[model samples]
Target: MKALTWQGINELAVKKVPDPHLQNTHDVILRVRRSVACGSDLHLLGGYIPAMEKGDVIGHEFIGDVVETGSGVQKLHVGDRVAVSSFMACGKCWYCKQELYSLCDNANTNPAITEALWGHAAGGCFGYSHAMGGNAGAHAEYIRVPYADGTAFVVPDSVADDRAVFASDAGPTGWMGADRGGVKEGDVVAVWGAGAVGQVAARASELLGASRVIIIDRFPERLALAGQFSEGVETLDYSQVDVDDALREMSGGRGPDVCIEAVGMEAHSEGVQNAYDQVKQQLRLQTDRTTAAREAIYSCRKGGSVFLLGVFGGVVDKFPLGAMMNKGLTVRGAQMHGPRYIPMLLERMARGELRTELFGTHVMPLADAPKGYELFKEKKDGCVRPVFVP
Candidate 1:
């Protein structure tokens, strides 16, 4: 099988690898049809997330056809088309019972690493490195999906492959931030970053009845895309305006009711702070960047809430704990629990309430994955997400 592999830091290659088969009683073998690149993949590409190894296949947002199914897989059939969750979970676990699938106890195959890093192990994520179960990713001709009935959702006939694929990750992730960030009717919401997740978060806010949604990014293309898909959504190019002042003006003197930081550990900024963060990161002193997060916390209304949808691997410098504590704010962060939101998102997609096809700015064959990844990583040619057909 031909699969995209991580050769080293900032490196990717499409190489032939061993094919996957049924590995567990509830496992299913998916013949990958559409697999897309995620901004989170950049962390692995840049070696920010530890436990990544040479030649590991890397992709998690995808939709595929079930070519084979294990005996215990009752919900899925051999020919069912499905979108699989990026995080693996055992539906019977206590965390899973509470609908916090990402915190499932039986998912991460290698628990000692994360247990040591964060005091508890999170659920496994496909191709997210050895620390997250080391499961083979979907960026291949075929991939193994464990806990098939619990993790894979059948894509509705009304939804296209490109659109349904996002229900696997970005859609669910963005929805999680807005739904959990306390977005309410008539609330004002601001989302940091204009990537797929941010754009989706903006739209999710609107669906959740937010009166106004604001999406921030330095790139005009991404901001434009956010406005296109989201009704009544405002966009701010962070480089051109003072974010705090702009947000305050938009929210009628008060800060936004809810602020979402989706830029994650690789967040970039301008001026002295950017250089300081860069120096610290390069010196191995800081594992994650907090430019967007700090701004989100500082710009949020005193009684408002902030949710982090971005991926952060380790310790960060200069988190705004003071403002968060003083302002009576509610701050939360989580990896998306796909099972909790995917079904609703898929139904929304089927009704055209969520438009994700626009995010697939570049689509190509699996052989061009290296080029697709390069374009995606560099944000070149206005490529929002490069979708690969394997």
Candidate 2:
């Protein structure tokens, strides 16, 4: 099997690797159909997340067909079309019972590494890093899926492969962002970043009854896509104007009711704080850039909620705890619980209520994955997301 392997910082290669086999009684092997690069993958490529090693396969968002299943997998069988969740969970666990699948106690195979860094292990994710379970990623011909009954959702015939592929990660992550942000009827919501997650977050906000949704970014193409795809949604170019002032003025002196930070550790901005963060990051003193996070906190309405869907690996320097304390802001964040939202998102997609197909701006074969990553990372040719068909 040929898979995309991480060689070093900013280095990726397609090479032959051993095919995966069922290792657990509840496991199944999936012949990957469609897999896409995620914004979070950029963090991995940039060496923001640690514990990755040479030759580690790296991808999480994908859909496939079940080729083989263990004896314990009764619900799924060979030839079943499925979308594997990015994270694995045991449905019987305590956290899983609460529908917090990402925090499941029984998934992470490398618990010691995570417990050292995060005080406890959350869940095993496919092809993220060694710290996240070291599971082989889906940017390959096939992958082994554990807890298949709980993690792999059967795709309906009505939903196309292009749309169903996102249910694995991006769609659910964005849905979780809006759901956790506490979007309500007539609430004003603002989302930072115009990537797939940000676009879906804005759309989800509208579906959840937010009267006005604002998306912030520096790219004209992404902002235009957000404006065209999401109804009642507006776009803001942060490079042209002061984001805080523009948001405040747009809201008539009151900040947005909810602010979502979809841009993660690698956020870019122009100013002193960005320069400071860049210096610290280059020196290995800190692993995150907090420009978007700071703006999100400062621009949120008093007593409003700020949701973080972006991936932050390490401690940040000079976070505004004062703003959070003085303004009475509610801060919430989580890794997406795919099992909890994938079904609902699939139903919405099947009913034509959600439009995710527009996100697939570039499609390429598995061998062209290196070129795809280059295009996506550089944002060349208005590329939003590049999907690879294996």
* Location of the lowest summed lDDT over 10 successive residues in candidate 2: 113-122
TM-score of each: 0.99, 0.98
Model 2 C-alpha lDDT versus the unseen true structure: 0.92
Tens digit of per-residue lDDT, candidate 1, span 191-264:
99999999989999999999999999998899889878888999888899999999999999999999999999
Distance from true location, Cα of 271 in model 2, Å: 2.3
Error of 1 at 138 (Å): 0.9
> What residue runs in model 1 are displaced by over 4 Å at the alpha carbon?
none
Error at 386, model 2, angstroms:
0.8
lDDT of 2 by residue, 129-243 (tens): 9899999999999999999999999999999999999999999999999998999999989999999999999999999999889999999999999967787789899989888
lDDT of 1: 0.93
Which ten contiguous residues of candidate 1 have the minimum total lDDT? 223-232
Which RMSD does model 1 reach against the true structure? 0.7
